[model samples]
Target: MRNPSLAPAPGDAVGALPSHWPRAVAWALVAATLVHAVVFIATVANPLVISDAWYFVDVFLRKYVDGQLTLGDFFAKRSAMDHALPFHKLLLLLNYRLFGVDLSVDAWIGFAFAVATLWLFRVALKRATPARDFADWPVQLAWVAMCAVYVSLNTSEIFEWPLLTLAFVALFCCFALYLAAWRALEGARAWPIVVAVFAVTLVSDGGGVIAVIAAALATGLYGLRTGETKPALRAIGAMVLACIAVKLVSWALAPPMQSIPMAGGPHAAAVSLPRLALAMTVPLSSGVLYPMQAQQVFHSFGHAVDMALRLGFIVAHAVFWWQAWRRRPTAAWFLAVATMLLFYGLCAGVLIGRVPQYGEAAFLQPRYIVFYQLHVVALLLMAVCWYVERRPSLDPANTKRVGGAMIAACLGLVLLQAPLDRQAWIRAPYQQAYVQRLAVQMEALADKPEVAPDKCMPQITVCRMPEPVRVRVVVFLRDHHLNVYSPAFRQRHGFEAD
Candidate 1:
């Protein structure tokens, strides 16, 4: 049975495509992907094991390898975040067992998932556009533009980093689960996929909570439309139960967290205002910050123009969401609404989890940019849907004007954003610095169990790791022949092998 949502919209150009058009889209995607890879290699292709990768190897992998942490503990063990990292731990162990701690393997695995996320976004965009006009230049260009920004270097912290790959894992799973639930809402046999994704979501990071809620809401909305409430109710009930279960298990196993009062005081408004402002602006600020971060062409714009651009995007999205909501519910509407939910939900999570410690800066971190990037892409799709729906009826001259303006905006954004993204990868600031420090520490620790007795080795303060812990991990690496101490790693990095 065909889904009502899949039926061609009025004046949709679905069947008007030329035979070669599909190939054009495919080639365009291919080109975008190649550029993504090239930018990754050019910027962040460092193979050195560093930071959280070492932390995981020390805490989780080392314990597991030494028979201290069993498989059961692996599933329940909490990381420094005080949240279960079963999936992340399992992946780290699997990589260790299969290939013996290769950062490239970890990075490439993350890169693959990043590509998969882009592909899923493409699928969603194709479905979400009301006109489904693949033959139209604007629609095709939108896909290409989305592909470019989806892999933007601003998100390298997740896509290019090995230990931090959990972000992409959660991201890809969220996208997959949402799409599968959408299919089920449309009356497809996607329940199994939904179930599988939900199971994975339990072990993932906080983003999984948003994924399940958004999906359940989407399903519940379907029930409202069809007047069939039982299945949706059951699905929502199951999700609630699963969420409770995960939280209970985490609270039981994880250490007690120090509570910070984020509200309910005379100064509450002052404390909360910055966080709220940062959260609201994250969707647009990422692109604005990236160009400025590049320290090249966009550096001239300074703080005032940057703030203006950020606020402008926020207001534009507000109008777009309102317009999307006023329209009848469709797949695109559901996607836009759900994505909006995700955007704010993630921002809320950041507020609660990070704002106390990091302040408003937490919202601006590169790691958080990946989530907002998806929001931006969804908004772009929504904009395309709005324009394409009206294009069929607009005067030719007016259509040309609007189309030309959109094209200019798209190209301008790409041109402004891409260089900074590329520059970030090229700079590869933290990765290069952290690895160099690790190498120096590893070398110093060589021929001894630790660094010189009187000397304190320089530390990467960003990691908040203690010197003793670093010394112990380095000793373990030497003894176990892992990471910098491993012969393979030594050979790869041009260090003399013992």
Candidate 2:
């Protein structure tokens, strides 16, 4: 039989809330999310090609166009060091086939995936709730807190950059896998869902393998604690076997240049162990700390404050975990812990891989903000669960005060993050200007093949293509009328694509 103490108090149910304040706060979070999305779409949603999209088009798409790469080979081939990115490649191919290579579409698609990730969290939150409904104030509070974290500007790269949608896809699959595992532990037939989601997650990014392993471990622990160990063991075994099978196949297809544990493997990271340890704590602090820039975070904050903040976050995490442990194991508690481990493992993997060479800046990359923000969401949810578990002991007036305080804190977080959001807003115009300049440079370079790479491109732009690939890419754009060369694109932005 399940422990009676594991259940939430009846007063904590949605039907028991006494005021309209929780609903109002929830609406405010939703509005904030919407405003963030609208602001992004309005200001920076252009199709000008840049960054990794350049390589994909110049290599994979070019190969397919030249008849050198078959559809099967295109999907199977790995790129960008160790990434097994067949799924991302598939999306790229579909966009090309459906709508001539358009970066704007890719950008919007990425935004869509980001929105979908938020929706997935809501689904997970629903499942974790004791009443399995958002009818209660605590559930509502947790949902809103997650929304605030999800819309953070720190992770704006995932929202704006077209290719980084791969991260969001991987996150979605990881969360789906956890939900499936939860179901299986409850005697539901969910192993197939787990298997399918795991396969998707495995190819989504290099960190997919680590995420799957973490999920399995968390699921197993939750099962063992709740007396459902057999199902948990089965889920873990399935995930482990799947990971091995996929890793072998991918290696056979194309051996990875370097192991993912550390960029150059264990020996490369051995000397940097102390810094790596400090960098690992970045995930905990990065969620809320908005340092000016990736490289400037340590510089701007100074060593003492940076170290203190990271250590403080560590203590905060420990307190929440202890609260979860003291209570009877609930799915909410387990999943919250699981989400934290899932991202924390990824953060550690990244820091271990890059911190030795790149230093603390590696952890502060804008792209990584997505991982840390989700980590913060998990921490917030853990706090919500703790609050729910304690609600029965508080008198009605005390309950009101605590609930009001929580809502105010969420609002305060939004206020604290406003500067970061404003930064994203201000940067959008500059990015648009840069893209326009890059288009002019590409158009000029296409016309003059002998032109030096350095002359036309900005020092800051990633569009500085090599001499060889540079000529081919511009010529391809010129002849095929893609990107800025597209007649339609030209008409819109004063350059033509066919």
Candidate 3:
């Protein structure tokens, strides 16, 4: 209950906010979630990227920019993944200059980025909430609960791979850009910010294409609905032209996939619509059941329960989004859902088209889960906003009932996840083992100066992690001055790929 004695007078700073409902319960949930995430990240030990950092520092910026190796030679030879990443390159270069390759520092940087993104998400939710719902603490707590679950599910990709910051940055960029376009429809002057963010996003990753395409689609539709046809048309045209330009430049910088040995093989199957549908329905609290990217997972009653809970979450979430959309029926709501769904729905296609094997195992990958979780969270926020707009409340009984239920549900989901969180941390040993095995050979090579610069550490294998890191690590150490291979010597052999 709001304190009658201390209630803010109308027109006062505090009084400007929804004054009828007490905000203590909602803020508590948000604060607790933030604290939990921070503490967990702080305790993480020796987290390493599956592959990018090693090669990025040792190859892309170091050799490619020095003019010692041609784009085709260095790219075809040293590139870990097929995509050309200006952002990744810049990150590697900046890190090299700022602090060198310190794993502890790098891990924290990623954690900070995630924390920042989470806060940005919180702000977004605040902006989306209708004025009538501003005092609806129950819905606010529910949003916090959903966000906690979203952060918990994608630890593998989010915490481990610093390079994935590109995706994180792009996701936020797209959402904000979509909103800017929406404002343009409403005659707000926010397109410059949209254009700037979008331009940087173009170089982040191939995944960024999902954001741009989705944003464009959402903006174009907004024009039709709002009768801002001319403004929308010009915005769409500018966005499309920018996207094309970025693609052309990125392609020019990117190595040809045909240059890789795998591309010569038989073509893989394209992802189907049904698979995309299944991806969309994954339960919000069902993350523990997924096991993310852990090489070895401990299964128990909780896992089984998680499976069932996810099924329930799927059904509940679908209905929730529909009800929210039905309530609001606004272009903003439509665009938010549409943009996110496009990103989520395209996961299968992007993976299948890039690496058929990845597409086959798309459901199991933690990296993909990040995008999937975003779509679900976006839906929830949009729904809650509309639901509140139509049904804001201030009664003590209403607060007790709605807030109690929402808080219980959110807290219940977190308690159920304790076992999985334990499992996620214990696997740090496996990463240690993986890193140790490779580190030993690296040390050996560093000690033996006589080994051929190109031939040293010829075949590297890391078993404790997933399958992508082998080619990644090998290419990284190939041209570096390890094993006492001098800079001149390493530079001379920059054309070789491990």
Candidate 4:
């Protein structure tokens, strides 16, 4: 039976020809993505390496840039205590080496990566959608617009974080798999593309086991739909093998985490589900009301409201997913759901082992989930497109209604979150000033002839300064390792020295 939702084929003049609408939309998407990227770079360039990004940059500068990979620094001395992953550190080091130590250079590198990621998404959409006429224009436009929004909204963390880089790499791998599957189904030799996809997939993330499983399920579903199972099975097997090989190699070459005190395995497993759900809901909500704040009277009401908002967000995501499954049972949509669930599960498991005190634990931070957020957003966009496409006989009035509702919902969310975004931006200059102050102090100490090179480790305390000044001084001293200071010098400066 013919699919009821399929768009009617155009006449002979347009047969097998790419439509002008899709092409125009693609160009506009490219432009929008570029503009958002530019704005992101401009906003984040000088902010103090806050949170995980700072640690990643520190490790990269000390270990990769200094050529001390064997016995190098992780994010911080504290990171060694917590078993920090080296992947982000490595990327930061490469960025520093290629572009120099300037924060501006890092900003530009991030912007470039953001642009590349958008182009990759565009390519993936073109490969995944089956429609060939002007009707496909809306689908293409929606996909690009969603990506643009994600890039703009999450730039505070995702643009500079190595985890986001890993996510992009994973998306590119998925895109490659889509192309390879298409080629294989068409009876073309696609082994090379499969191999390339496998390679990229392996290097993208440590949790790539989850991605590989999702890819396998996607390939299996595609094969079943098309009545060709062997090639898909082979592709899945290849992907699995690639993931295993990468993990083995990483285990061998990277520093062992055994010495670091891991959160108890059982504990880690226990917290997985709740944390995953929390992470998924919190960022999508209108305000940040961390669960830990519920104990405080002032924030208790806000916390309750936040919980309600989270439930609403999850329901929204669920509705979109259901619509996609009903309209299009494509491999991509299925895979997107699988990946989201797997990642969420893994996150829940990991959270159980870590400290559960929400405020003190870094894992509770929403930015940690930025990697999976891309996939979630992609799935939602695909669902929306599928929903629109399924109403093939949709009248102009109904179409307008659906389109208007979608736009209104999105705009409302943006408006509701505008306060948070503004606060983040307003605080950026303060972070920049703090970093600049620390840098100046470090540079001054580094220039002093009396400070020995061996004492330049970050642990030394510069005690002489006032509390605020001392905090920056300590950060500076830790950064440069100026450990030995004369008590006389402290007296001269009207401060205590250690």
What lDDT would each prediction earn against the true structure? 0.62, 0.65, 0.51, 0.47
- C-alpha root-mean-square deviation, each candidate: 4.9, 4.4, 8.3, 8.6
Candidate 4 residue pairs in backbone clash: 267-352, 267-353, 268-352, 268-353, 272-348, 272-349, 456-481, 457-481, 458-478, 464-496
Instruction: Give the distance in Å from residue 33's predicted Cα in candidate 1 to where it truly belongs.
Output: 4.5
User: Could you estimate the TM-score for every candidate?
Assistant: 0.82, 0.84, 0.71, 0.65
For residues 213-321, what per-residue lDDT tens digits would candidate 1 score against the true structure?
7767766765665555765676666666766676666556654332221111113222568566755575576743543463354566655666776888778778876
Ranked by lDDT, the better of candidates 2 and 3 is 2
Give the per-residue lDDT of model 4 (tens digit) for 1-498: 223232232231334666677567657655855675566556544422333343333333544535665633432223222433444455555644543333344455545655665565555454445545223445554555545444544335444433443444444455455455545544567565447544444444434455556566666765555455677667666666666775565556655443222222123223456665555454444223333322232354766766775687677667755654454434345435444554454455345423353322435554454443444454545555454454445676886676666555544433433443454466566644554444444444445524423443231132222344334433443444322132332333233344
Better of 1 and 4 by lDDT: 1
lDDT of 3: 0.51
* TM-score (C-alpha) between model 3 and the true structure: 0.71
lDDT of 2: 0.65
**Ten contiguous residues minimizing lDDT sum, candidate 1:** 260-269
Where's the lowest-lDDT run of ten residues in candidate 3?
2-11
Between 3 and 4, whose TM-score is larger? 3
